[model samples]
Target: MATQDTSTSTQLSPEALEGALAPLTAALGDRLLTPPADGFAETAAVFLGGPERIPVAVARVRTTDEVAAVVAVARDANLPLAVRSGGHSFARHGLADGGLVLDMRLMDGIEIDADAGVGHAQGGVLAGTYSTAAGEHGLATGFGDTGTVGITGLALGGGIGYLSRLHGLTADNLLGAEVVLADGRVVQANADENPDLFWALRGGGGNFGVVTRLDLRLRELPVVTGGMVAWPAEPGTLATVLATLAEAPEKLSGMVNVMTAPPLPMLPAEVHGKPIVMALVCFAGPASEAEAVFAPLRALGTVFDGVSEIPYPEMFVAGGPEGGASADARPGFLGEGVWAPDEAWAAAAIEAVSSAQHGLAVVNLRPMGGAIAGVDPAATAFAHRDAAWMVTVQGMALGLDGVPALREWVASTSGTLGVAGRGYVNFMANATPQDVSDAYPEATLARLREVKRAYDPTNLFAANHNVAP
Candidate 1:
């Protein structure tokens, strides 16, 4: 168990607290949390894992008003407040040292308007929940590959998914957001209201304020043709597959993973331990049309081909890994589209990943283009608007003991694939202060700082991708 810091020099006075917290508790009843509550441990455990830190208290807000109240309390107390949606920050950005943690997981609620092609999801809602709810209406929004990621975090960081090529990034479809400023004021931000904050929230991470609700623009989507296609681990075959995919249609988006084949019923027993290029693809079109689009890949002589026509929601299920264990690796986003020569750095990165000593190291390449690139980089805080491929180097270890070696391998391997030295905030696992700085451009960073100053002058919300106020 993580221990909490009890030094009161930085804490609020009892008199100051009485005035700020009395009305909040009166409004919320028993929703607020102190150190010794039964829910404290569970609330603290919400963070994904890795770093250990404990907050002075946990605020279990159930509504926008409750969120505002908690913010007010933290502000009055001069306490560092961490806002947690899904608690999925790779760097443990949702946990504070000894301050207040406003756990927003309880606020999940999804409402879909099929006729209007829009969906309203609360800040705490997970991507899987929103995807499933919208799928019921034959509608969908672009989100990250993972279903457990929070809608707030992914949308804010410019969500990428199967629908990215056809539609756009998740932030591109954001209609509006209800945010609670540091001053405890709730305001709706959109194109017509507080537009600067709206722009900042699109890709600025959690630098502005705590988003209570999000109104997202939805697309008319029914069935999607998608699944995995696994090819043999031979060097020539892997090289050809990647080269072919580079010129593939923008309507089809997929992720190519070069790693050791897992022992599954679908895989041949002979090819289980050998290396393989597992391609997870999703084509946003009719089943018949999608088959034709995937013909080139099918002809690649894959050892196992699992491609099939499935509903859009099923795509989410296919990408989810079976077990839950902590893994260490470094993640970076190449700013210069996918223009690297096949014989140069790209092939070298693949070769290094395939030969890594880590149990199942992989250089996962995600195709990006089309609707995602159509959006202007300056239109939102997400600056990697024109990137053609998002690559992640993942190393999965069995236990925490292997973290050091795995981290070293991932770091050195990522250094070799270097393009711009920048990274996508969502995939960043071991982001340093410089890595965080590199995620945003100078102009965006300056504007974010100003916004942080205006909203959280004292830097109360300093636990996330922090920006100095």
Candidate 2:
């Protein structure tokens, strides 16, 4: 528990603020930034469009000891502290309102041991960095869709990507982590050391401590058959896409998006700004079988087909679709098997997107359950193993004026299609206590709370989807 002498408010008095910031400034020099600093704006930016947050200060630390120093300062000051890695959090947990932030970007480092089939990644390492390093050794770890996302946050929230069906989740591949506890003590968590803390860290978010580094398990995957395949949106398009994915082997995984096609050079001019069903797929099996694996999708009348054998790292080179500067996203698990009357669901999604006048709206559906379901629910903090589809409805606009309508569209569409379950923590921004409760099962939440009690009883680390102690 935090000491009684520690101040519990983020807004410090002028004298208290000066006293609290002086030590960090003296120790870190220019690395410690206050408002109006040259790089403060860039360092404080959030990835997915959320309300802007101005942290009281930002510290760019290089080593684990430096991280501990920052944590200790924040602890003694009783100021809210947040960690920034890739800064891709939809909820923008990386930024603190009138609090301190540890900018871990300078800690980026990665070491690959091909012989041991493992990779050690610093908390600041991005998915692209780790994947590129591992790809050199014909190895890879399962991470989320985007390359710019910080690998640690993604892994902590149960990473799901093209390789998920083949290699389970990023959390499944986690072998160990080096963390700085709420009390400013540095420790290691793994199967044989601090086992309970390790279990909670796998999918419990950054509630217990500040993770400085991660030890990840890697698989030998030199290349894959992966790329985008799109077709004109139709009543039956979504069903065909999902049914094909369901029948696919574990080696194949894909994400389907129902949205208005943007004007890209590769796409026909006529298809631009028109509704379409686009599928981004990856097959990790034998390259020779790639064509056969994708034959069914081809039969659906593709307007564009870019699928082909390529180095696994190449898939992330271009990244995914562009998101609005400010966006609203709702992600949830689709239980009861792909929503009954697939055609109706598909039609509703298409209609919603087509009628949206303010901003871009998309209905995303990714098939779950292959190696993902093979893990028992009790094995980790992420409990949605039996789900068939991971669904998210999102909309983005230039300003706040267009937000209300987008929100209405998202809520209505989600209700119509039935996207109710423990929501995906990583995609949820501005989540409430009930949202946190809904993200975990009762037993899982209880166990997480126990770990929380043992590790962070006073809740010093409450920036994320907190599991209250």
Report backbone clashes per prediction: 1, 1
Clashing residue pairs for model 2:
91-429
User: lDDT tens string, model 1, 33-119?
Assistant: 655677777777653455456676677778998888888877776777788887777666666766677888899988998888889
User: Where is model 2 poorest over a 10-residue stretch in terms of lDDT?
Assistant: 1-10
* TM-score of every candidate relative to the true structure: 0.89, 0.95
lDDT of 2 by residue, 1-469 (tens): 2211111237688689879888888888999998888988887776755556778889999889888889988888888888889888766778888889988888899999999999999889999989999999989998977888899889898998989987898998999999999888899999999999999988899888889999999999988999888999997966777788876888998788889898887788999998889888999955698888888889989999988888888878855555454456678888543332377778888888898777778888888888889899898898889988888887777676787788777778777777755788877654567777788999999999999999999988877888899
List runs of model 2 lying over 4 Å from the truth: 1-9, 336-341
Candidate number achieving the greatest TM-score relative to the actual structure: 2
The deviation in Å at residue 328 for candidate 1 is 4.4
